[model samples]
Target: MVSTIVWGTGNIGRAAIRAVAAHPALKLTAVLVNDPAKAGRDAGELAGLGRRLGVAASTDVEAALAAAPRAVVYAASGDLRPAEALADVVRAIRAGAVVVTPSLYALYDRRGAPPEASEPVLAAIEAGGGSLFASGVDPGWANDVLPLLVSGLATTMDAVRCQEIFDYTTYDQPDVVRYLVGMGQPMDYRPPMLAPTVPSMVWGGQIRLMARALGVELDELRESVARRPLDDTVTTAAMGVFESGTQGAVRFEVLGIVGGLPRIVIEHVTRIHPSCAPDWPQPHSGAGSHRVIVEGRPRIEVTVEATDEDGNRAAGGNATAVGRLVGAIDWLVEARPGLYDALDVPLRPAIGRLGRRGV
Candidate 1:
């Protein structure tokens, strides 16, 4: 079993901890946390897994790396503190930990990522002989290989549209929902996340990744956004009340121009409440769903709804991401030292995972 360390205790972190403990080929060695209160807590308890996994959380970053774990799952929030996250991941890589994470947006498609971002990682990988893969549910394999794999079923293919339909009410990141996404903010408020070129900055890499994978030459990247205000004052189960005039829903797209036409599209329909966006796309049956629509002969639509413990779709989404990244630990440990992207990593099968406690 590959020794593994999980960093962070937030949404993705909790899922990562649960995943590592349950993975047959991965042994949970250490868990690192930023919250002092969480430092001494049992890893399973931190993950709300009901039972303890005999691993405790620690805050001593240096000491954890000193153990030289074979793999690291860096699930800290990079949405607000990207530099710190990057540094932490770099430190792990330098310690020779084959790291997999969803925090780094630029690394999602290293081919289109800026040199400044990739340079340090490359240097660290060279120095430590470790590998790194950055991926997640949406910008990760869902849009990249999942779509490509689905497109294989089509005799002819035209445009490939990837979509994320989510109700943000269950999403635990209130800051991301209210501030960054501009939900519960005034109509005139300009959400930093939706500002000019921001969508491209976040999801443009996914577009480029699909292009490179499919051998499609993208002429340019384009973005469009639409938002709606709550017609009536409403309160979410988690977040406080949103006034009628405040932004309650958002729909946006980051498009890749192929042959002067928008061919590859990454679209998001996010609502603070289910009632906010009546006309927009809805999740298949729950809080969230990722979909791929192939426009061609025998047009096809594939939607994935992952429901984790307690039937929470958001938790399920996080769990799926953890499964994807954590399941890759053994492969990463056996591979050459380098940074890998979505297309490079395979959807590893549950070889010995059947009838397991975690599955």
Candidate 2:
């Protein structure tokens, strides 16, 4: 079995723990947590898996990596601390452990990634002869593999649009929703996510990766953004309350233009309250969806609605992201040491372990 360590115990990290434990070929080793209070806890309990895996959580990064884990699932949040996240990933790579993460947004597509972000990671892999793969749901399977697969059926193509339309009220990440996304901030406040060039910085790689898959070069990359304020105060199960006229919803698109038209587009329509943007598209089910629209000969549209154990759609999305990273572990171990993204790594299908119930 491939020995694995789950680094971080946040949203994606907890999901990674469950995925690692359920995979037949992967064994859950030590879990690394930054919180000292969480140290020495059972991995299963931390992940809400209902049983102990015999591996305990630890605060020592070196000690965990010293155990010679074959792969490290780095699930820590990089939205706010990208440099720190990049450093952590490099440290793991340099320790001779294959690292897969959704933390490093810039390295999602190494070819288009900034030199500063990709260079150090490449250096670390070279130093330790370990591989690295980074990806998540939107920047991952939904845009890269899924669209390419659907485009094959088209006799001719017009444009490709990948959309993540979700209500953030149930997402429950206060820091991300209130501050990073500017969900409950004042109207004049600018969320770091929708800031100038930030959308492109985060999702341009996805557009370029799809362009590569389709064998087309984009003429340019562009971004369009719009924000909506709440009409009245609203409360949610997770995020406490959002007041009237605050930045309640945001809609943005990262477009890859070809021939002066948006040929490849990635869109996000996030809302703190469902009533905020009645005009914008919404998920067909509980909270939200990931949609792929191919405007062409066949005109294909695929909408995905996923739910977690608690029936939260956003948590469900996070789980799939964990699956994408953890699923690539064995493949990364076999692959030559280097940085890999969605294009370099193949899509791993869901074949849950035979004896694992409700995986």
Candidate 3:
């Protein structure tokens, strides 16, 4: 069995920890936390497992690597500090551990990433003779893997559009709230979109992944952001941290082109406050569903309605993500060393259950 270490203690971290703990092919070795205060706590308790694994949370990277884990699941914080988080993955790879992450910001399109941000990690993985791959549910699945899967049904293709819509109201994580809806802050406090030069880190690689998989070479990419306010003051458990109601909805779209011609359009929406548009698609107003429309000779339109087994809409698409990650771990370990996106990897259905029904 390959011994594995899990990093972080947040939502994805917790889900990954549970996945590692139950995998037959993996041995749970350690849990690493950046916070000094969380050090020495049981990995299981930190993940709400109730049972202890004899492994404690830690901040010392070298010590964790000294334990000689075969692999490390770098499920750390994914935010503006993605480069820093990837630095940790680089260290793990240098120690001879295969690293797999869902950080979502690691150089999806190598050309777009700053050399300072990406080169060191690639160099370390190369020098260590280990492998690294990053992917999340939406970018990993809906845009890349799903589109590739759908392409199998077509004899010829022209354009592909992938849309991911999910309700932000049920998601209670602060970082998630901030990343999706820009909650707890005023519109003026929002960062400026840098146009074609730099798009939001979230979907840059996703757009590129889709384009490359569909055999479309993009010449130009454009991004636009739109927002709407909440009808009234709202409250939730994420309150104080992410004040409810004032800022209700936000949408971000990226259009990819080949020779200045549009080939793909990727759109992301977050609605914490309720609003309606006449053009918005039905069933939660473009929330809680993923639609991929392909225009080609065959003209295939596929709509994947994401819902829990009980039929309630899931939040953040994390279940699908965790399931895919758990299923992909074995393949990721055997993958060649270098940076890779979803389309470069293979994902398949599996019997190893990882996600909790209610969470």
Q: Worst ten-residue run, lDDT, model 1?
A: 136-145
TM-score of candidate 1 versus the correct structure, residues matched by position: 0.98
Q: What RMSD value applies to candidate 2?
A: 1.2
Return the lDDT, model 1, position 208.
88
Each model's total of backbone clashes: 0, 0, 0
On lDDT, who's better, 2 or 3? 2
Local lDDT at 95 for model 2: 89
Stretches of candidate 1 exceeding 4 Å from the true structure: 137-139
* Candidate 3 ranges beyond 4 A from true positions: 50-54, 110-114, 137-139, 179-181, 192-201, 240-245, 275-287, 297-299, 305-316, 351-359
Q: Estimate, for each residue in 1-359, the C-alpha lDDT of model 2 and write its tens digit.
A: 89999999988888899999888778888899999999999988899888888888999998888888889999888999999999999999998999999888798788988999999988998898888898864537787778888999999999999999999888768998999999989999988999999999988888999998888889999999999999999998888989998998999999999889999999999999999988999888778889999999999999878788689888888887788788888888888899898888877776666567634
lDDT of 3: 0.68
lDDT of 3 by residue, 7-57 (tens): 887766776777787776777888899889999998888876767877789
Error of 3 at 269 (Å): 1.1
How much is 123 displaced in model 2, in angstroms?
1.1
| Better candidate number, 1 or 3, judged by TM-score | 1
Expressed as tens digits, the lDDT of each residue in 1-359 for candidate 1 is 89999999888988898888878888999999988988899998999988988989999999999998999999898888888888888989999999999998888887877887799999999999878999854537677888989988999989999998888776778898899999999999999989999889889888888899789899999999999999989877778788898999999999999999999999999998899879899987878898999999989999999887688777787888778898888988888899898878888887787888872
Q: Tell me the whole-model lDDT of each prediction, alpha carbons only.
A: 0.88, 0.88, 0.68
